[model samples]
Target chain A: MAPSDSDAIFSALADPTRRAILSLIGEHEELTAGEIAAHFDSLGRTAVSSHLRILRLAGLVAERRDGRFRHYSVTPTPADAVVAFLTSVYQNSLEQLASAVQGAATSEDTPAGRVEERSA
Target chain B: MGELILNNELRLEACPSELFALFGQGDAAVGWLFGSEAPLLRPGSLVRLALPLGGLARSPGTARVLSCQPNRRIDLMHETPWAGRVVCRFDPLDSGGTRLRVRVTIDDVEVARLGAELGLLGGYETGWWEVPLGLLISLSGPAGILGRSTANCAQLAVEEINADGGVMGRAVRLVVGDDATDPGVGAIAMRRLCRTPGLAAVIGMHSSATYAVTAPMAVAKGIPYLYTPTSEPTAEHPLLVRFGETPMDQLHRALPLMAAQTGGSRWFLAGNDYSWPRAVGATARAVIERMDGHVAGEGYLPLGSQNFEPLLAAIQRSGVDHVVSSFVGQDHVGFQRDFAASGLRDSIRTFAPLMDDAVVEHLGESGEGTWNALGYFVALDTSENREFLRRYSDRFGSCSPPVSAAAEGVYEAIHTWARSCRAGGGVEPTALLSGLRRSRFNGPRRCTLGGSLESLLLGEATRSGVRVLDELPAATQAS
Candidate 1:
């Protein structure tokens, strides 16, 4: 995935209300906008609709229409993309650390050969 | 915008109560989750878990239970590497299974930084002898301005030691805990550091307020703790070694020169209301009296005080030509900026013992002409110091925060501890302690453990950085 797409997912995940909305939708197979709005006491339907719109734009949620009603469900693809990005970043960091240590070990002034000589 | 919360739920075959019992089983639950061993989870218990990073390395995570309810909920707050809260909820399902909900609320920025630290730990090669050292410094809060440079310095020292075949032929690894500049937080960080497996020593660079709380904890755990900042003299303990100068060590050498240079015998004492500052104020009063100088005024503001108008007004009214201010970190920066803006910069010469390159840079133009005395200055023209700076810049980039006395102090503290380990021929606590008493380093600053500093350098801050004015004589001979 592109960095911007992952950024969009993170930006979408940054909001508490949107996260709650995503969690609510994720709990069941699917939920209409009204059903998700019912879980939050302070949030109105309009606010819920706006949050769902943002989640949709971020590709975190998918909306389907059937018989004049809309159902919302989480798009696992985006969440998996986030996990993949984090995993790859972690792996890259490890590789960098390993190579840096190896570089230090190979330096001429204090080489691993010298260490072996001293130990002998 | 407040915090990012991630919620995950899993349906297990066991019942709610039965599943809850597994959490209290300690190693079983830890092994199940992190594939590591852990102590029993209880309220206020420190939980140290080795979180594996892609089978390459294990990142140690320390969390404390805020509250735990039997078979229902367990809430935890993560301390090190990142800051976050976790809540586990157990609910009974209709089909007799349990729906376990885990909600983690964290700051995204911390998660990104955690990835970097995990990468550093990932380079650990299996079967290599490793000496884990704890570095408890303020990565956040008021003293956070000095955090990056201090951390960088510690990292540089560890790398240098590794490049030189490590301590006692064992590679050194640093485990960091952020004190956040709060005593309570420092206690948590100290507990986490003490609990780390194979932890050899702890090097602290936070405020003395935090030191008072953490020092006893380190002593109780029998770990060698080397505190690396200016502080008041405490009762000497074998395991606890202080590398920085004391209030008397700084003021005795600095006050006379400052008095002679400025030709002012009347002085005003200002500092944060803490043990170190109070000790500095007391020492300044005595030294001034001994020299037949009068302490024209004195005041102690609480830490993190930004408004220095009242203090400035008092300093002006007291008719003192020189002031000895001991405010630390951001408080130091704020006080200096306010003093300069008050137009008092023309008449009053300020002597702050705690000021360093980082704080001077933070002051920028306002730091001009301010006098400071410390054991190490960035402007020291010595081969040892130049090499130290070169290594630091090479590792952390030249754009990194300047190495100040506080930063250099920790760098020297690590090398000194490594020397002690070499002297004792092991990394055991008693061995390290005995070795520390006789440890000497010919680094940027010449230091002997449990002895007076070889010399204290007086510096005057300029727009670029602090310029070394003169090397004052050592206050006391090496014992």
Candidate 2:
């Protein structure tokens, strides 16, 4: 997934109801829309389904068709993508700092690289 | 200890797959790393790496592929003489490129040090110790009580390192050189130390004058030198690392508290006529002036001036209630004894930045009511200090020299050097120097150089013993 896709996943995760619904789906292999709504008494079926739609759009969940019902299951790709994106963001800053230091060092006398070459 | 993690990242104009292919194939990673004609990189497979420091180490070391996630992460655990682990990760960058991060950790101390020497690896923490390599390090200080106490701390550090299996799986032998508190002899000892074969680095805790001569000499010879207990602000040097509180660090945090408690704006500055004393006096004067306080008198005595009677009389005539003295060694002890005997002890409030537990103990009843503020004290009751004291006493006994901040500075320096050696992947001068720049960890007294300046812990001495007054916040480089 592209790094920009993290924005969509983050937006979907921003809502507490969506996060809780995602956690419930992750706990069970798959949950029907009716079964998910039953767990959250405060949230109506339309509200729960709306949250599921956002999660589905973010690629955080996969919807499977049963005989006459639809079941949602958590997808691992979005989470992995987020991890990769965050790691890259952190890595980029460190690299920039290292480059800045290296540039400053080079402006001065480049000390002799005293390391010996590897023998085959 | 957990495995050391060193992370380096680069943004390249390529996708994750494109970057992963560079390492996924045997041929691409050949010259860059593994160097074998047909280097296999599958998970659970064995791979051989061409050692960078070939003359100083074995040629090709073997490693096992711990795990591999295509287009993301690859972990390799080396099984060579110096065992270690390396992990490379790739991710997509916002600028339509790939960000590659590399982390290397050596399980074996010797190999880790060597690995750190040859690559872009920076400093890191170490997990365990296994000493198959023997690294000889030299320690120099005065042979007097203060210097001996510093040397004892170095010995304690050596024992601690050996107990952990030494750096890079190599046992360390600490060679002690006596400077005898003389700059001429100290320079000679340092020159000899710089010439010693197989010498990894040198840690010294002598006077600032000794450091002035010896530090430059060590740098000139391309030897790494870590100096402790000298407050003379040093000029930038490639091979020298100083571990001491600058006058600004001590006075800025300590003086205001001292002035507030004693409720005196009038101050007297008396110290030995040396570069360190001169610098400290200047710092104290600046801090006092900034606090809207006035200097009542300034006294400069020769380094070995035993007669404080004249100085005491001069201060009494000046009617200064507060004294800021920077005498070192026996001169400090002498001043304390004489000042106490003069009956001025009851009226005048004295503050000495260099006074430590040993000086306090030597002063006995005479040093009572004297106040000292510094980065470390033997009386600090932190868990790390407690563990250090427990270990130090166990090794050296209760009769051992009192562990001053100067001694603790040396102890911390050794551990810092060891970690830098490991981070640089080897003990080569250039690698060690680079690694030392990036090194960071907590030790006894929590002594550390967070940046260019060593972080200081401020404390004051009470009539009964030393009590920690405050901890100075960490400073950045040059701040």
Candidate 3:
């Protein structure tokens, strides 16, 4: 099943091992499965492959097969999408908050639109 | 002490305006800084800094905006507990990145001390700022001694771009591949680089023979490829652009002078069997005949052929006063050493259109009196060239490879590509081509390209080093 964009990005970024793999791929153009696996000496190739499969499914990483090796590279479009989504969220929420504050009636000399200070 | 000041600068992979907008504009500034609602910053707008107390008493302060210069500077004057003037200056970097500087001068030291006592600065960690990651760019060339010099310069160009803020506010990452001066290897490297996702463009192919095979392949793949060091400037492929001086350009600029210096009408030709050398030889022959010089002998050596004894003997017997050579890379070094050992330089002064610093360094005393033509030289006395040499030497140091025209071509290619990338606003082939056509820069040795791939300045390599002499007129270059 194809995961949703936010779910996929969060899932892909959830694992420390996957994040490390993504960082390694980011530093290079593309890293073969064997080359990527070589970085984790203690882990078996199959274990690393499973993690790569998860990342590929999440759309955070793209894979190209050549001969016996499958090369993986980070697709930054998803990260860009995440940034756009966050920016939109911030913009909309702030706009709504600003209008709500402006629409309210004034109270006390401190001004009603201004945030009230709570003394400790 | 008077007013204690704190200053910090960060190189961020973002445009100055974009960074300033995030910090000084409406909503975005508040969201970025405090993750809460804040009013639009006007000259006298009051901002409430609601310090999030970490298991301590909160100290809320009212800070008044002193000034707001869009994409430039924003100054804030605090009135309550932590009284200080927080000045944020945003400067655009050359690499399309932003250099954001923040300076805080505490006028009321006691207030700052009280805020510190309340664990506002230490616990909240508001003193530290963040810088985003740099973007990535890739390069390919002959990997070893043959290509490393060009690769080094390509890397240097990227560094300068990144320092300036990178292309379009993104940091540049250099992806390098070794062509090994072989066509087959170059093909594989090109394929590997093509498969690389987010690759902006490809630059650097040192050998014409390698380029001849790889250019068509890269064209077929629709990659925006900039041909550097290889002098065959056929713009047949839509996606391929030539940045190096063509053999015709070099020969036309330097041949007449070389013929005059030799004071003879008889000449011989020798070069590696390749598209560039063959083109150069043809152009030389035409130019020499035009100057009333006749070709006495000509020989084409297959690459990796060390035995130049027969060829040298033929030139020696032909009574040719000038020997025009087109040998490239390590082969050129080997041939020059052999030519010097054969006692050819004693009688026949050689004219090589492509000989560079690496060849000269390898030839040492042998290359002493030889003549060469190129677009750039490390020994150029101009301020721009001197600055280039200074940066290169400062970065790579004394033991670094000798700077050559080919290497400088690689450097120029990257800068041109970056500029075009900026102008075109993207790295797509058509965008880059359009941008490349519009790119211009004042390069080393007063060399500049306004539009298209024509280099206005050309130079001759002497015993002292490359001396800028002839520059083809714009009309002649256009023709």
lDDT of 3 by residue, A1-120 (tens): 112554455455444355455545654668887887776546578877987888787676789888887888766554243322222322232333333323222223423212211121
Model 2 TM-score (2 dp)? 0.55
Interface RMSD of 1: 21.9
| Tens digit per residue, CA lDDT, model 3, B2-79 | 554545445555677765655523343233232222355666544543322101222123455677887888787643
The C-alpha TM-scores of every prediction are: 0.62, 0.55, 0.55
Could you tell me the lDDT of residue B291 within candidate 3? Answer: 83
> What's the residue-level lDDT of B59 in candidate 1?
33
Best candidate according to TM-score: 1
Per residue, candidate 2 scores C-alpha lDDT tens digits across B44-76 of: 454533332222221333445777888888777
**What is the iRMS for every candidate structure?**
21.9, 21.9, 19.1
At residue B233, candidate 3 shows an lDDT of 61
lDDT of 2: 0.61
DockQ comparisons of all candidates to the true complex:
0.01, 0.01, 0.03
TM-score (0 to 1) of chain B, per candidate? Answer: 0.74, 0.68, 0.67
- Model 3: DockQ score: 0.03
Docking quality tier of model 3: incorrect
